[model samples]
Target: MTTHNTAEMRICDAIWSIGVMLDYTQKIAGFVTPELLDWRPEFPAGDFAFSLGEQLMHITDIRMWIVSQLGTEKHAYERWAGPYPGIDQPWTFRAGSHSEVMEALESSRQLVQPWIERPMGELSLPTAGTVAAWEKALAAMREKGEDTSQLEAKGAGTLGSALFFLLAHENGHRTVTQTMLRMAGAPVERLA
Candidate 1:
């Protein structure tokens, strides 16, 4: 297998693992009563502000955004669209259910998997329409002397960056979701 294929496989495994972890976390979250959505912990005392529903939806959005960036010249640091709603924001139109989130994630994974397997040369960084807008945004960031080397080093301008960001972001939220489950009096398992 080529290096690109190897990297894609690793990313695929990571994505699958994150999906499983989200599934398990959602199962535990389901046990929490609706009345406890606003519950907060006593010791260490941090607000468990976002609900389980919100977290799942946030994960779905993150997946979509990452998948959309793949195979495009659009840098991940660039802001393409308006204030996209994330976990902390109100999901006005977006589905916030566990099933809905899973579906979105699965669909995005299906779309992105093929692109991930392609060799680096096969990838094209086209700057057109939304991608062009993204490039403009990135240029502004560069003008400010922002060090985007970390992003570039991790294949930020390609599909690999999408996978890397998704994995890292999911891991961070998984930790938060587990904490929320534990606070809700549900049996939590350490994500392996």
Candidate 2:
């Protein structure tokens, strides 16, 4: 294979690993109780900042947003459309319980899987032109007081940056969700 194809396969392999990580984290997060998902600690203590429910929803949103950028030049965030929660202020997208959140997360996760294997989700978008997509997503993110420049910096305007952001982001949240899971009185190590 050519260098480009090799790189693509490498990226796909890394992303497929991300799928494994997501499954692990989501399984732990599934233990959160409805009340725990809504419960917030008094202070930000290592991943305890947002209610467990909110954080799960946010992860789902990030997955969806990444898919949106690659799927189209027409981002799904312009007016903050429905069906999926828009990354706007307060993140008012509500999930009735952990099940609801996991359902949405799984749905979005499936959507993004194709993105890792295919060329930018096979939407025929420009490569390296992904910088524009990230910029638009960041602008909308800023309106909601989120800053992702650090992530953009890492990617140097390539889609890999976005892919890495999603993988790392989900991996990072695992600990937080597990902590919440334990706090909610679920066993830390789940059994088969």
Candidate 3:
């Protein structure tokens, strides 16, 4: 019997959780028919919305960012585009067919594998870019005089937290995508 180091176990758990979330996302995405891929909720003009395919693409985009930003690969860092501005800003991502979106997710996993397989000192360091983005995201909530202390604490700032953030972020969008699929008459189960 082997005894496990707590830090190692925590890191393993974090990686495992990310993997499980990715698998669940893939399974749910599998149910998205081509017909439902472009469907989005009927929001008012100027309101924010994402088509089903865009949602999947968005998930892959953030995952790629995390790996590129925090990973050990010099090439990935060199090729990394700057951080995304905001949700309201125009997205450069062009949503493709179901197979293409699935391929994107799979490639994101491959890109992240080598980074996560090795331990890095930066894993525990605060992720300044992500923290700044969180502050921007919380601006509206703060304006409403709402208590956002808890959320601020949970914001992703470390490489480890950023990995978990991928799950939380994707899971939130997956709900919207799954709902749109259901409305489009596709059978999207509650896989998560």
Q: Judged by TM-score, which candidate is best?
A: 3
Worst 10 residues of 2 by lDDT: 73-82
Ranking under lDDT, best-scoring first?
3, 2, 1
Best by lDDT: 3
Q: Candidate 1, which ten residues in sequence have the lowest lDDT sum?
A: 73-82
Q: What root-mean-square deviation over C-alphas does model 1 reach?
A: 7.5
Q: For each candidate in the order shown, give its overall lDDT on alpha carbons.
A: 0.53, 0.63, 0.68
Between prediction 1 and prediction 2, which has the larger lDDT?
A: 2
Per-model TM-score versus the true fold:
0.51, 0.61, 0.65
TM-score, structure 2 vs. true? 0.61
* Clash count for each candidate, listed in order shown: 0, 0, 1
lDDT score for residue 127 of model 1? 18
